[model samples]
Target: METVVGIEDTEDGKFEDSGVDRSSSALSSPKQISNPIVYKLVRVEGDGRLVPATDDEVMEVGDFLECENSEMHVVADTGQSLECISIERSSSGNLQLECSEGTAEADMGKLNAKLQYIEQILQKVKEEEKQRISCGSPVHSHLNVDSQCSADKFPAMDGKVQSENQEIPSIASSLNYTHSSGSIDQCSRPSEGVIESGSSASAVYSNLKPDLSMSDGEICLDKLSIRELHELFKVTFGRETTVKDKQWLKRRIAMSLTNSCDVSATTFIIKDNKIVRKFEEDSSGNLNAASLISLENMTEEEDGNFKDSSPVKDCGSDDNRVVSETRLGNCSIGYELEDENHQTEQRAAKRIRKPTKRYIEELSENESREHNPRLLISNKSTGHGHVSPTSYVRPAARNVFSEVRIYVTRSDYLGGSDVQIPCVSRVRRSRPRKDNTSLMKFHPTGMSETATKLSNKLLEHCSDAGSEIPDNVLKSRMPAKFHQPASSEPAKEKQCPTTGTAELRQELRPKRADSCSHTSDDDIVTVPTAKGGMRRKHHRAWTLIEVMKLVEGVSRCGAGRWSEIKRLSFSSYSYRTSVDLKDKWRNLLKASSALTPSPADDGMNSRKHGTAPIPEKILLRVRELAEMNSQVPPSYSSSNLAAGAGSVHGRDRSGYL
Candidate 1:
């Protein structure tokens, strides 16, 4: 047949254009259609055509359904839309949908009632706070409340029923008040029917809801989170809460409720001021009066206990839970031998126990030593900026010291313990400049032997704890000193060689023979070599006696004639070159300028200098020296006279005979 054919490239890349009818093959292959639902189909392609669709008519989700001449289109309804088919085949055949036809606001009276109730509760709580403030008791007033109620049968808020006031004994211990201890008791009890402990606890226990429910069911108090419970405590007693100690918080809340008489709960008894135990008195109210008179502590089953030193008399009623107890010995810090009668009285008391461990001793058993933070006893006040009887035991400074010590003592570069924390990646940079630049503008160019010796001693101890400087670096920083004797004959001096750091650091290495012959009098003379040569210097120091001799020679020979002075007095100083003599005299003049008192301070310095009595012989010599210069007879101030004969001697130097 000469008919059109569809061409498609096969997987092998061959174009197959066969002239054949694929419709016949598909029809003969059995149409894979499952049970299909019937729909009334209307064709809108040509003229108006409406036809009932066969049961097998193809349909699927997203196929557009449009009413003729309408702009809207909805997805084809594929799921069972017929009520008869769904009812016949499904298990939820009888399901009837109930739609809410009215708005929730239509029931205003019920909502308003709930709002009013919540407002009233908040008002009551606020009023209680105000009263506490007036009475000098904060909401966070007392560490523990003292509720005057019968045992277990806590009065409910509605006053209609009673519930058991209960908690595990472990919780009592965790109410540790880890920070401080205080009792500003003036805590008012909740009104009758204010607390529904059993129902509230159950509700909170079951669902742990915080928000108030608007359902028809009665609203119950929610289980407080650690923070919420802490806030409750802080507002009630002004006690700080430890967020980390969740165990302590839950117990504290329970204890607070137990102590409140207003909550109509059972009273909690304190043991040795450490443990909080429950206290149950008789309901007849007779025991309340007797309790005031009696010094004996109360006793109960499984919960409350207090120490009683009072003699036990049989009440004859089985209701009295007190049992005569015997103790083998005492574990108190300062226990004394008991008197015969006193011991007998203790023996007769209705206190019974198996002689168990103390509270602290028991606590030690459950906790491991490794996991605990060191707690040193702190006797000082907490100093929390409160004018209250609060003395909290804070975490001591020892813990901080321990942590810092651990960090400092780390052996590796990474400073890692169990977990690895890499050391900071420092950038590669040149070494820091450590050579100290002199601060003074006019530092001495040279020092006498005494000054040099003193400076050496001081420099030896100049080690900074922050960064230790190497010995070679320190030695390199010291200026070269000259100690030469002037002489008529000139002698060649050995010069120091310019050495690298490795050679200069010979002092740091093992003791070795010095290769350089640079002797004691060799000064670090900077001689200009040809050009572009490193400067070389020799090590030497000037002595005080040599300096004094140079001064005397300068005074005798006059300052300008350096070679003559060097030959006359410094003859034995073979190392004293003419230039060295001149340099020495110039420094002496500079030093004399510092020693000479300022002109303005002359009169004041005279009286001040009077205390330093100079020898009469020195004054006579000064007068003798002055006689030779009678041409311009010098007038000397007391300050100049007190400065010594050097100032006087130098005074006539300009026209010395």
Candidate 2:
């Protein structure tokens, strides 16, 4: 295209011009401003080719320059333009200049080239993403990042990222964006470099910046907007804006209206605001990596290879707990539970002020839960093994995702076998599936001696606890008619795990003997499975001692402090969670009230069919407490009735009110 406007000869490199012409087709982007946008600067080499300009290159107004063997000159200086029209940095950091038509064309051309390249890359990426989604591959999950500049940061910038775990502010934030420091920078425009052929210049800056103090490159203050800069910072550095940043991001707009050369093409392709380019290659046309320029999308085979070859990093290596560092479409990360100290350090390093008490508590709880499987089996050796369900029924907490860590426990299953696999612990709230008919299907190799021992302990524990169930409720506790007329079968294979503070971890190898017993088909309680589905819950038989402990705690603590009571008594039964204590207390109160014989006597009697069966001694203590705390009945003297019209609190010589 011909020059939008040509000056005869600027006096001392000054524009002898007025009226900021914004309608000119030459401006890359026209917003009716008086100042012209200066991207990066370039020099008209002795060979007439455009070479990169440095941040320190100072171009005077009307300075002569050239691109593609054609002569060009500085058209305007941003700082000294007009009284009502001076150049200022857009939040994006690009200089906002008034349009005069002569300059924007070059910028628009570069922008167009970059846009086309990115669009091509994006189209390819979209297809790949669709393929992955169709194949049911997990989309990478986003981590809870601190000091992160997503929606809550850089409100003035224009870019965003997509996270499976978070709501990033905008798509514009996802662009290969970055920012710079310092104030109203200056840029000079060449008088004749417009490629009047088509669309405006697609000029923008690369996220990289060189050392400003050591170069003879042309000096232009052109760069990406502040928003773009901040985004680039987060993506590239894995951090947000700092107080004293010194980034001098010189402009690297896609070359336009000029000869294609080493200085023209970007060293990297910026697709979806990410650096899709290879690091080994510069802006030269020859790239070290070949797939970048290839037209076809990467096949699943290639993706598999890429993922396999990608580096694996643990979170402990960094300031935070990074479970997985996915080098994918964007800079997304994954997280796992960290230690309290590590958590504190991460928060402190980030300077975030959120309260982390609950987080720490949760972490500690998870650590405790990690050892629950073995602990639960070992706990079968307890005082109330046959009485309290709390002894065998472990307390479950919120579901936690822990890496399977297998222990070298001796088991008899699989005919003296040794295998390595993680023992994953998950607190399942639902019942085990009743459909599993064969123990061989579950056990395969049969449990080892250790497993056998655990099963025996569990069986004996259940039997002992069942004995205290007062015989009458045995029918309801066990629905299976053929449960050995001898009261022989196990407690409740149909038991559903209760949801609470229980750490129900499953061993890699389980006991099959618990299943292949003489129990009826209906009594075949499937042990809890880890993955997921839903099954039946067996009632926990509370021992008389456990009931007495609940009564004592209630009497001493004045009720409502189940956690404290649990801590004081029944401390050995780690399975007895605060919720269990509370539930048992409520049941004891009900049973005491039900067995009590009205106002005639204290509620100390025990019924044969009691849900919350307590010992007589404990029942008597409950009655005592009830009496002590009971409100006194009002006096009913005849004088009081006569004086009921008078003051109820008044007393006379006869001691009547």
Off by over 4 Å in 1: 1-530, 598-657
Residue-level lDDT tens digits of model 2 in 332-383: 1111112233223322322111111121112112222222222111100000
lDDT of 1: 0.19
Model 1 root-mean-square deviation = 41.4
Model 2: lDDT equals: 0.21
Candidate number with greatest lDDT: 2
Query: Considering every candidate listed, which one attains the maximal TM-score?
Result: 2
What is the lDDT, from 0 to 100, of the residue 210 in candidate 1? 26
Q: Candidate 2, which ten residues in sequence have the lowest lDDT sum?
A: 378-387
For candidate 1, the clash count comes to: 19
Residue 259, candidate 2: C-alpha displacement in angstroms: 89
